[model samples]
Target: MEFPCDDNRISIVDLPEDCLLAIFRKLESDTDRNSFGLTCHRWLQIQNFGRQSLQFYCSLTIPNLSPLSQVVPNINSFHLYRLLSRFQQLSSLSLSGCTELPDSGLNPLQYFGSNLQSLYLDCCFGITDNGLSLVATGCPSLTSISLYRCSITDVGLEILVKACKALKDVNLSYCSLISDIGIRALSRECHEIQAVKISFCRNIFGIGFKGCSQALTFLEADSCKLDPEGILGVVSGGGLEYLNVSALSSCIRGDGLAAIGAGFAMRLRILNLRMCRSVSDESVVAIAKGCPALHEWNLALCHEVKLSGWEAVGFNCHNLEILHVNRCRNLCDRGFQALRDGCNRLSVLYMHRCCCVTVTAIELFKYIRGNVKIKEEELMYIGPKWPFFR
Candidate 1:
């Protein structure tokens, strides 16, 4: 059968560009997207220029993508503001781009400043004090802001606390320019600050938490330069539920951890002291006795905790479900009994790379606690994958 030329008839490629984009976004599979792109050069162009299927960003999906930024280095504020005007009630936005979204790029945030509740900008070194000021002034209602590896100093942080008093969560990880002054400023004004992450912020001595101590629930100060008093100050509030002080091996000791166990362990749930070489049996015993409600604990690389600590954990932390003692040089078969006897509800155990714990001991432990799941997962360099994080 011979078909007509059909030159005059409209084809699938002739669908309006916006309609095509909408259809492309609806596609959930990579194969389908690839097939769609192969239809014609026009669709390919659209797919190539835009961010990967924003799927009509329900707000905060890193819209106006990095590819476009790479293509159009200086995407002026006019076009960005105009595009954002569509999402009138938008309350969240994630503008992550490596060097593409400089301080000038954040200028468009002024439009969504009032209703914006959350903002995430990571590795945006271009964002300085001035750009922060712009955001702070516009988004007074902002409750959460994550600025990872930014170049903001205490001056900009002060500017932020002065404006956003209702802030509840802030991540200043790797922001080296900020010091205790910024923390003190936040403590003074940001009374609602509930969660704070100062990871690698070596300048923070931990004195500033006193202001929001009553409201603080989550604090991730891993690898920070906090001494014993600083650790005490952070947990003294007793309202904390999750705390991560990993890699503070040289700065933290048993006394600091014991303080948390003795006084603030009532509400404490998840504690990560991985790589704290100084944490010994006494600290572990104290924590286990006090924080009976502890759900998950990570003691990886803590070589100092001995059989006593494991025994104490089993005796007290009946609710302990997940335990990680990976690479514990001294963890042996005898210690496994303490856990097997006490933690009846223990569901998961991670003993990867533990040289002292024999295979027969593991088999015996498994035979007894058949309901518990055991896995030997070596530590990977992956970023922290916890609930409070991010």
Candidate 2:
């Protein structure tokens, strides 16, 4: 037996500095980043020199100032402030799901003025209009902003929207403070806006969107207190390309969704009607007949729909690519078979918690991406398995 010392030898000295920096930047977990930072002097040097985007879940146990910390420690604050100053290259920032951080901790974006672009503060309990103002004023060039479940008021949104003129994509879903006034301002000021998601923001019912000429590519105002009048108003505005209003939690079952199906069906590309228990199979059929351009649809958690609803969607929407029917116990294998039979361009399918659907549904739906998954009955209903995210 000959010992092959040459074959076992590995060297980091030959690797380029840029290549090493790229490796450090690719690290997803902050713990891993900190570990790599401790490996060697060479690694530390590369980490400091490299420009990297940081996404923190905000826990006090994470060594540095957690995103949950309402009052950022002086040392960590100084460190983050210094990092942003030295590396003006930081662009993407997501502080979502950290319920602990208070308003003070989130206001530091003013220190990062003009550097941040993509910001996701979804489900952050500490966030309010004041914290939002800091980001909008500091990051004037911000294009993408998602603030779902934040306690952002209309006043805060108004100020922030005025500051962010170049905004193209925004998601204010479940921001209950927003009213028709905020929507009206967005319609008036944000002319370049392409996508606006205000799901369950039930304030924009009777209020009108004045600027309808700019051609908005997407609008998701699902489950707001909408009627045929509100639906007609949005469609008449002349900018919608994608519309989602599956569940209104308030008035989803009435003629609002039907008005959407009949009025704006020509321009829509995607629609989400998840958990709209009020919506019956008749509404789905009407929408399918009206919205000829609709391609992607989500009917998750809707118990009212039956085979007739699935048949209409399958028959009319030939370009459908993505479909979500999670928790819809009414849809059986027959509906899955119909989806498989008609939808040729389908790529993503989510049928989580649909008891009527078995593993057979997953096998039938073609073109599913690697990201999509199907949970078993016991696991899906009882609790999540390991490596699965809720």
Candidate 3:
């Protein structure tokens, strides 16, 4: 028995060193570095230089660890902490899905303190205020932090706000533990803070975001327990560029939206109220009158709004690019006519399950040579069937 081998072979030495490095950088995320390290001795040498900044969303599981153990030492908390002490140039970190890490104290801080600028602990249930305090105190360069769905209290938040005064963006979405007191603390202390996301914080009962020290650019809280006063607090803040309050769909009818429109008339850009079922043309007109600078708006499934509201949006929001009005049963051909005529700049429009639109409306699309000459390059309609009925 004999084995045949190809005589032709490419020389790794001939390739430019920089070219080899580019390949190594791209392979950094391939766990255990097997893809690049096993390629050749030259490839293994390229890995030693280390890339600029390595970021990982999931765990950086060690290869030698068993399937049951993502880290060394058989899933021990202390051992896992030791494993993370190796990353040197990690500036940004994302741990969106890790729920096993211990959150009682700052056990993870020692590994993260060196050069971290941004940290995302979204949905990491293992962490508590103590861990957060460690982050605020240890990571001096920290500018942005997200604690989405993390269990946190006013104490933890107060410490973070007080310690990380340089912080700019903080996302506390779905942290039900927070209330008006925590928000007031954030507003009073975090002066340099620019953008704060506080969606689904149901405990924020009556207090408004009136005393916030910094100007807010984005605010979102859908399907959380909040009254008219809470809604008014955010609208009165006035520096909002993006706003979403679908949770208060009924409370923020025409009047609330009108107030938001009037307050954020200059800076408002994106608005999303997918299930704001009670919002009618009254609020739509108010928004059209007030928020002229809107670029993208989503009123998907808003039942009460009539066709006239679409006309107001078409006529006023010239810079509008994306619109999602799916399931607006009351919408008619006249409203679409306004949308086609006034919303000439639209690039993406979603009109799924809209029963009022006729087959004639489908022809109106630029592709069908209707009056509205929207470029074929744009436009996206959902639902099946020709002419898109209902």
Top candidate when judged by TM-score against the true structure: 1
Ranking by TM-score: 1, 3, 2
Model 1 whole-model lDDT (C-alpha atoms): 0.77
- Give the per-residue lDDT digits (tens) of candidate 2, residues 61-96: 245664555442332344546666665656776666
Off by over 4 Å in 2: 1-49, 59-80, 97-102, 106-108, 204-215, 218-223, 233-242, 250-254, 280-286, 298-390
Q: Give the number of the best model, judged by lDDT.
A: 1
What TM-score does model 1 achieve against the real structure?
0.78
For residue 326, give model 3's deviation from the true position in Å: 0.9
In model 2, the clashing pairs are 58-67, 68-101, 223-248, 246-273
lDDT of 1 by residue, 79-179 (tens): 55765554444566666444455677667677656778887776666889988998987888988888888899999999998999998889999999988
lDDT values, one for every candidate: 0.77, 0.68, 0.67
Which stretches of model 3 miss by more than 4 angstroms?
1-77, 108-114, 205-208, 211-215, 235-237, 247-250, 365-390
Question: Which of the predicted structures, 2 or 3, would earn the higher lDDT when compared with the native?
Answer: 2
Q: Per-residue alpha-carbon lDDT of model 3 for 181-275, expressed as tens digits?
A: 88888877767666777767777753647745436776666665555566556666567677666645344555445555654446777877777
Ranking by lDDT: 1, 2, 3
Query: Residue 5 in model 1: shift from native, Å?
Result: 44
